[model samples]
Target chain A: MKELTILSGKGGAGKTSVAASIASVAQNAVLCDDDVDAADLHLIFKPEVKEVHRFEGGQVAVIDEEKCTNCGICWSYCRFDAIHTKAGSGFYINAYQCEGCRLCERVCPSKAIHSYRNNNNYWFVSDSRFGPFVHAKMGAGEDNSGKLVATVRQKAREIATETNAEFIINDGPPGIGCPAISSISGVDAVLLVVEPTRSGLHDAQRLVSLTNSFNVPVYGFINKYDINLQVSETIEAFLNKNHIPLLGRWNFDVNIVKAMLEKMSVVEFAPEGETAREVKKVWEQLKSLMLTD
Target chain B: MKTLITSTTSTPEGPFDKRFGRAAWFCVLDEKTGESTFIKNENAEGQSGIGTKTAEKVVELGVGKVISGDFGPKAKKLLDKFGVQMVIINEDLKVIDIINRIKG
Candidate 1:
């Protein structure tokens, strides 16, 4: 199955909206939300969870106060001030502060600090109106988002293969960070939803380079293109220079937000509207390109 | 006692940097001798895990206290585990003024 990841270098570039709309148009597609951090694709898909799995991301050191001999060895050895000592209480580990390095656990003369995997993170397989969806929620201050993204993508791929789905629509996270890298790696193609602003163009250029490094074919579309026509033109020029096809330029439309409020794709919300037509056109162009390859 | 303060510049006269992991410089102040030295944060431009690296640096320096506008979750955990005093100063004060405040 062909996998298409919709990525944006900056957040609020309508990546989820575009991906949701494309999913509504594409047939035989398994949708996956790879944006574990601040995941919002669920806001539109309204997935009914089918399966839930715990994500044991990383280890966090825990201190047993009862086993105390407060020699301060663990305190001095720990680099992450995760261990705190109260006047009455000996020492305690701050779950939020801990990176789970386990240095304190090892160095403790009293052996009071024990490290354990934090199983707070969770991923889900759910059914949405579009199709089978794979998504995850990373616990607050949770590490290893890249791993969580990979996990969901793997499940989505497995489901796609078993069901003979033709495509996998991945709603990727913002920025060129680890999660973005995980989402782009080995994807069949990338669709960058760019905004018409100076930072938008700059960040999209970075994302383009990142995708290029992974040897992934990328296409671009300017979201809210009319907001800054000059910047949109510059973005188009950059995409052209990089040999990336500009699929569609969508005008600034308030209906997109209205559609989101109703938890529906613009195409579903307004089937015959201009915005929906533009989204459908973009999907058609993307499908044609995918078929040619 | 050794105290580390995140700074925007390498000099003590520079403003205090709010970010801990991405701070440009770390001003190490000697409380006993009243002398200060600046260490450039090599992990400032790192792609990831700079908080842990910065915390390791603070530990390696044997700093007893850290003064910054804010510390990341990882850094705060490391510093707390090591019993390092963390002082949060939200005001936009110069490095010198912070140093004086600590001295006082």
Candidate 2:
């Protein structure tokens, strides 16, 4: 099966909206939202969760005050200051500050520090109108996002093989961090969503270089290309210089916002509009490219 | 009193007079000769606020005391296990300079 991942260099670049649009047009596709951090595709897909699984990122150290020795040993050894004495009584690990290394628990002479796996993350396999979607929800301020992304991808692959889907369209997270890196690996192609702004170009370049490192074929779609025509031209030129395909360019339209409010992809919300048509052409090209391979 | 500067690398002589995590770096300077082995850190990278396996390494290196920008719970426990005294500093300062300031 061919995998088409939609990615942006930074947030608010309309990656999800475009991915949702592609899913609407693509048939027999397994959709996965690899944006484990700040995932919002569910808001649009309105998926009904079929299965839920817990994600264990790591362990957090907890201090038991009842053990009675406030010797300050943990206070002096802690690198993260996760352990602190509360007004001269006992120590505690600030969950936010704790990295869950469990060193304190091992070193505690009084056996006061207890390290345990923190179940702050969860992943879901859901049934959406487009197809079966693999997505996840990370607790606020929780880490281990890279692992979660891998889980989502694995589930998507499983479901796709089970259903004999021809494609897997992934909505990837922004930046060159762990989740983004996970999304780009072993994928058939990547659809980079670019916005026409100074920072947009800068971030797009970073994402392109990262994708280049993987030797993956990449295509670009300039979202809101009309906002800054000069920048849009620069983006097109950069794509040419780098030999990355420019799928299509979209104009600034409030109908996208309206479509989102109505819980529909832009293509489905405004089937005949210019923005929808551009997205459709891009989808068709991507589908053909996948078929050719 | 021997002071150990540490990094996350499981090796000695790692570069960087200070590390990125663990409150920037530590500076434990001597008051007498002013001669100090600057223990710069190159690989002290990991999750924050857990424990300090690296800090345990610092204590094992014969550091009598630690003067650092910050100390996490796990590192602090190991330091205590080895009877290492630590003076936590609030400001981010030069390692050697901060050690000198503490000595004074």
Best by DockQ: 1
Writing each residue's lDDT as its tens digit, candidate 2 over A8-79 gives 978888888888888898889999998877888998899999999988776788888788498878778889
Give candidate 1 misplaced runs (Cα > 4 Å): B1-104
- Local error of candidate 1 at A218, Å? 0.8
Number of colliding residue pairs in each model: 12, 22
True lDDT of residue A205, candidate 1: 89
Candidate 1 B-chain TM-score: 0.96
lDDT of 1 at B81: 95
lDDT, residue A268, candidate 1: 95
lDDT of 2 at A24: 90
Error (Å) of candidate 2 at residue B8 is 34
Model 2 segments more than 4 A misplaced = B1-104
Q: What TM-score do all the candidates reach, one by one?
A: 0.72, 0.72
